[model samples]
Target: MNTITDTSIESITIEAADPDATREFLAAAFGLGGRIRVRRSEAPTTGFRGFTVSLIVAQPSTVHSLVGTALAAGAVEIKPVAKSMWGVGGTVQAPDGTVWKVATSAKKDTGPATREVEKVVILLGAEDVGASKRFYLDRGFTVDKSFGSYVEFETPGSPIGLGLYRRRALAKDAGVDESGSGSHRVVISGPAGTDPDGFAWEPNPSEQ
Candidate 1:
């Protein structure tokens, strides 16, 4: 197995019908740095192809506030803020139709655990979970957990966690339509450059 040397998710690129609007919405909601890249697509995209970008905050209190901020910034509520066994979380759809899940752990912790924006998790819905998992595993992502329909990978030294899920199930969880085609509308970057699963990283001058 090839061990991936660099695990950090340097940035995410998105293809959108209105790149500027999507970029503005994301910036306003998450206060993203230059890490997010957006490009305008000549045609409309369809399908449950896009990935879910999760922001894990240190404080549970920040969850609701962040959800509200996203709503005010033109994100439609997909799942309302609620506490579950896992933690507090809510789902929303950005103006460009990207799904986002904002959450934090339910259990209280000490010290730095109370900080905001604990980590960013990228969950890609795959047409074939097993194949996708194998693709990532071959590229050096350690298996964190796995089940029949889902598998998560640990990106060491990275504030990002990557996962693969069944496309239809993911769409259902996000309260969105499972029928979409065209562009996946997502990009992931790391030191490895690209993966067998078809995610690629483009050179960013800002990061150089």
Candidate 2:
């Protein structure tokens, strides 16, 4: 089914048990530039929520800065920051059960650590990458790249970009197990609906 295809990602709502504390953590840790929101929800959820929010920054310093702050804010380190063929990055799981990955394409430090974030990509774990890609295409999203088990959608000017990855692969990448049930405990505000993989969304409050 065609979910939110042509929509712009205004923000993401992280359904949290303690909204106040979670909000504070996100603000102090990632400072995602107002791209994240939180609401109280006791919905049963466990393991990997089948999604992860990524902080795509410009330099390695920024990666260290963001990940360091996240760790200091009580986020558990899932993967240590280090350089790889794809650049330097690492993963962490927030106290609220949300997985976050901080990464940069630059291997070398560019000047000093800055709070500047180049982009944020919401990666949804998909059962079938091709099927999900078609769903988005039918709805209206243009493909930036689609190869093997990954598909990235072009979302120019949007606060958050979208991508699809195999569920198991996504969980492995986040250093978690692909075993989650109950509500995802997260909502994509701009899309305002549920996708094929049971990923949920809600209308952008600003648009409403």
C-alpha lDDT of all candidate models, in order: 0.75, 0.87
> In candidate 2, which residue pairs get closer than 3 Å at backbone N, Cα or C atoms, i.e. clash?
192-202
Superposed on all Cα atoms, model 2 deviates from the true structure by an RMSD in Å of 1.3
For residues 1-208, what per-residue lDDT tens digits would candidate 2 score against the true structure? 4367455888888999999999889988988756988999999887789999998999998998999999999999999999999999999999999999999989998687797888889999999888877877877889898888988999888999999999999998888889988888888876555788888877787877
Model 1, runs deviating above 4 Å: 1-6, 107-115, 191-208
Off by over 4 Å in 2: 1-5
TM-scores of all models?
Answer: 0.83, 0.96
Query: Number of clashing pairs, model 1?
Result: 4
Give me the candidate number with maximum TM-score.
2
